[model samples]
Target: MIENPGILFSVLAFLCAIGPLVFIHEMGHYTAGRFFGIKADAFSIGFGREIAGWTDRLGTRWKIGWLPLGGYVKFAGDMNPAGVPDAAWLALPAAERERTFQAKPLWQRAIVVAAGPFVNLALAVLILAGFAYAYGVDRTPPVIDQVAAGTPAAAAGLAPGDRIVAIDGVAMATFSDLAKFALIRPGQAVAVTVQRDDRRQAMPLTIGTVRQRDRFGNEYRIGRLGIAGGKPVYAPVSLIEAPLAGVRATAEIVSGTVETLGQIISGRRSIDELGGPIRIAKVSGEQMSLGWPAFVWLLALLSINLGFINLLPVPLLDGGHLLFYAVEAVRRRPLEPQAQEWAFRGGLAAVLLLMLVVTFNDLGAVGVWQRLAGLIG
Candidate 1:
């Protein structure tokens, strides 16, 4: 049994958030292909039966799909939506072949395939920049409001009304800078500099570590000084600075994701943090509840992830197509059709397997099995 309203909202929010992004991504390929004289057979935003459709003058069938999760643009000379070519495509009239995706020059094909991910990247950057420009960055000085008694802050003589000037010798531009600096170096001593009553003071403090777990069951230790944050003040940004700040923030997010993946690969981080469509829907709903800005932020982040993941050299993905093109370029001919077929099959299997694992992780995060076990117990 499922909760109607909750599940409905989650599904709806997930669709609303994902549908446009997927369409935009596919359009990147479609538009590029069209620009290079590569004809599109169909442009469908979703899978399965068409909800609504119209045939364009260009002989392309454009339609909405019943499923709102993802979409694709089937190109001329393509065997399938995944852009694999077939013998029939090569047997087409010479003039028609010129407009088919497979008949395009290697460089053109590369551009068309790469366009999807590149468009996603551009969308994220643009969204971030637009939001930052409209609502300048939230700035709050790292001022301690209340120092918890018996905590490391109190032990270090940190008092209320004191402002954190720096942590670990790094300038604390905002309270987040301090928290990030402390959290990453749990159980480590950090050099703290504070501004007290117009006087600057430097003190050494050992950060206390506290074990914390998220709803996903991933546990980690974070350094805590037990100081409550003060009120935030939004700093207005100049038109020129907003986009630049957005770029910086986007870069930081990409870098952080890379670092996290690296840690997980090295076994320094848990694979349990990996999530799939379920997790995404849950997060999307939660973010939607938080408000539009936050939801948009999630969209931007997801866009970045989509772009990044699609750029990976995995089969059945845009990155995989790029990889194939690279090899073809080097060899002055394409890979054997049988070899490409096997590669696609393997890639499809791998993608589905990965999705299954992430969905299981999502179920675990939701505590479905835990509840069943509790009932049995």
Candidate 2:
């Protein structure tokens, strides 16, 4: 049992991190379905054979699956966990059909499909709000305190006393803002507006790129502006203001994520940076070791990512379902069954391919290939 605490912690930490998030995500769908008078056949966490569960008063079979990867709430008419409509169920009488998800109006179906991801996003915002209320918010100004030699800031003619006013005309209110803006735009040129001698001057600067490794040896390729900010100052956030602060913080995270994806798509960033379950488990365990605060913070960040990813327009994902619903709304009818079948098949393939790529990346990051090579040698 004591053979490897790290592996044990990683497994446990992964469960702890993923379990509730999945529960909440499925719960969102369940609650929304119930609100529309739709029946849920089952609520299962993870994906395979049942581990344990109980039937609810509403007749929903609440179960835990052996696979701890993800969970789903099966509605009355769902063919499977992916929420495909059962053709036989759809052929039922009108009175029976009223209680099924597909029988609902287009708008209601859209809301039901969207509720899960929105709930995840809302959960993240609340988590951030709690942190802001507890520890306050950073109010540090974006004034340059240092410019490292042989760096972008040095090349851009930035000086220590210069006060950063904006980047490409977007006002930089805080040092955090500046950092967030730069972090997602590595190797991109931007106009930096700085206030010097009571005058503002905009100068073109190319962001630098750097590869860094964490304590756990996970690699990251991020932007570096090569300038340091003045000492930070944090102001206490009141209860009323905390939610707004949380929203702003959440927006920054969303913006950064979007920018990073854009960079990856544009070939400005490496696809190797994508991570999967293994990397998440490793990081989750490391954060758990640090303390609850760190772990909880990771939870919030992951929650946001989960919400964002599910919104992508790919079949088998929440976003894909929404996309289909959108087409139904526009065409005034659902897509043909054959078309949907093929779309879902394609979506499944895409999702599986992505999982394979990220898993390969995770293995490489953990040096699994190196260890195997060493053994072979």
Candidate 3:
């Protein structure tokens, strides 16, 4: 088991990071429902027994629960979470029927339900922009901070503080460019020009073999250098540039996700890389240990993930509900209860199965289950 302060910090970071994201998501539903004249019975963050709660004049219960996993906003007529089906409430009096969710116009219902995921997406974009504004955009500069002990640069006698003047005969400008070059050639040799000790020199170095794993069981490959570069400073941009930064960051993340998914589908990437909450928790802990900045960045990444996952077309999720709303919009009526129920059941199964697989993968990656088995043996 991981017992470092890093792990504990990560656990806290995970909660702190997700707590507000969930709240914002629920708030979206609450806001839209209120706008459409639908009363909300309760707005609660987390699940299980309530830790703190207060009732509003509107007779709504707003509470904070002990669990930090997620939250929900219950509508006045929701009855059960999925909302009472139309036929079941037909026998109720007219006044009572008015409060029921099924009685609302399909468009209104769709807006209320879809609001949660939409809020998440909006939060991601805003956060990205905020990060960019605060940190300024990181541009690639052709500088080598330090080369790995057994990396190609190390073998070629490259030392720390060597600024790469050029790569592959092309003028180098940023660390990003150097990073891209390194990533592209995992085991290939390349010519590099560096300024070391007020002198310029050219060297041919073969990228080192992949070391793959470290003492902590973490895996990373070296570029055959004994030293790497220090942090190179970049000029911060004005607030006006923040939104553009956010858009670019969001686009990059979305593009990367799409590419990764494609790679997985095409067998270029392994399914073993899929991780669940366990992996996230571990990573969160490690990042938190690194410092506040790392922790905050992790929070932003997780927020984006939460938003992305909630948009998947799985019944019981925000996306699944939206899908049903689309169907109703076209058909001019809700789908049959039997069909909806079945779809929900399938979705539930799929989600649970995915969680299980991801959990297993996470534990395996962390060597937790293996250690446990070894102890038993």
Question: What does candidate 2's lDDT look like per residue over 178-241, in tens digits?
Answer: 8888877778899999999889899999999888876666667778899998888999999999
Model 1 clash pairs are none
Query: Could you estimate the TM-score for every candidate?
Result: 0.79, 0.95, 0.74
Q: lDDT score of model 1?
A: 0.83
Model-by-model lDDT, in order? 0.83, 0.89, 0.74
Question: Top model by lDDT, which number?
Answer: 2
After superposition, which runs of candidate 2 have C-alpha atoms over 4 Å from their true positions? 1-5, 80-87
Worst 10 residues of 2 by lDDT: 1-10
Give the runs in model 1 whose Cα sits over 4 Å from its true position. Answer: 1-5, 80-86, 138-234
Model 2 steric clash pairs: none
Q: What lDDT does candidate 1 reach at residue 337?
A: 77
TM-score winner: 2
Clashes of 2: 0
